[model samples]
Target: MKSEYILKTEEDTKNMAKEIAFDIKNKIIFLNGEIGAGKTTFTKYLVEAFGLKDEVCSPTFALENRYETENGLIIHFDLYRLKSEEELDMIGFYDTLKENATILIEWADKFNIEKYIKKYNIISFKIEDNNIRAVTIK
Candidate 1:
């Protein structure tokens, strides 16, 4: 099953994120969308909802970032620059999935790690014509 929402502005998107936060915890979330699709922005709101004390930024160049909260931990990953699946293997991505932390990945549509990614949530971000964004979750 899935749900879709039209977020007309950044604020609308954040509100949607808040709604999603209620259903998630220590789960893997794959963010799929093109560049400038607000993947990172939604990520920030989600992280904040979890009570992260610091700022949240895209792990674009850093590849990945880990944040701690009083309740648990969250790990954000950017796989846009990865040249090959071997690169992911080098980063111990598989092992990371076993850890006790919530995982959110930007540019996740690039990988075919279906076996490992199964049984997780998938968020698809789509840019609309009127400067709005369409977000779908399954």
Candidate 2:
């Protein structure tokens, strides 16, 4: 099953994240969207809802960022720079899934979906306008 939502601004995005926070537990969330789509912004809201006080930024350069939260740990991964599945293995990608943590991965299309089958909840975002975005959850 899938659900869709339209967000008109940053606040709308945060509100949506708040709603999702109630149901998200130690699960992996795959975020798929184009550049400038608001994936990072949505993640920031989710992390904040989880009680993170520090700034939340994209892990594009660092590859991953780990945030400690009351619920557990939230691992944010940016796979934009990763070139191959071998590289992902070298970095212990598979092992991360075994940990008791919530994962939010950006640019998830870069990885093979087979590896995450039945292990993740996938969400896709599309920019509808300068201030509006359509989010789909599956």
Candidate 3:
């Protein structure tokens, strides 16, 4: 199943994130979007919806950020800096999947991650006009 949302303001993005968070069940979510398309913003809201008070930031430099919440463990990964699939192993990507956690990966489409991950939720963000974002979840 697929769902689409139009995020015109920060409130819309926050509401969408809260709604989506309820559906995450030890799943991997692949976030697809260009820079400034609201991926990180939505992630911040999603983490908040999970009752986590920790600050959420893009892990572009560190590669991965782990959050331990009352709901469960949430791992956010940014694969933009990764040059090869081997680096995923170095980052313990596969090992992390074995844990009972919700995984959100940014720039996941950069690699052939679908081959390894059979089950996942793909949330794609497209810039429509005047900073409006069209987000689709599948």
Q: What is the TM-score of each candidate against the true structure?
A: 0.93, 0.93, 0.95
List runs of model 1 lying over 4 Å from the truth.
none
lDDT of 2 by residue, 20-136 (tens): 975766888889999888889988998888988679999999988999988679898899999988888888877887788888888878778555556688789998757679999
Looking at model 1, which ten-residue stretch has the lowest summed lDDT?
111-120
Error in Å for residue 93 of model 1 = 1.1
- Steric clashes per prediction: 0, 0, 0
Please identify model 3 stretches exceeding 4 Å from their true place.
none
Residue 115 accuracy (lDDT) in model 2: 58
RMSD in Å for all candidates: 1.5, 1.7, 1.3
Tens digits of lDDT, candidate 1, 15-133: 88778875767989999999999989998888888887588899989899898876578899999999878899999888898888888988777888767766788898999899889
Return the top candidate by lDDT.
3
Q: Tens digits of per-residue lDDT for model 3 on 1-138? A: 339999999999999988878797579999999998988898888889998977999999999998887788888999989999899999898888777899999999988988887799999999997889999998
The weakest ten consecutive residues by lDDT in model 2 span 110-119
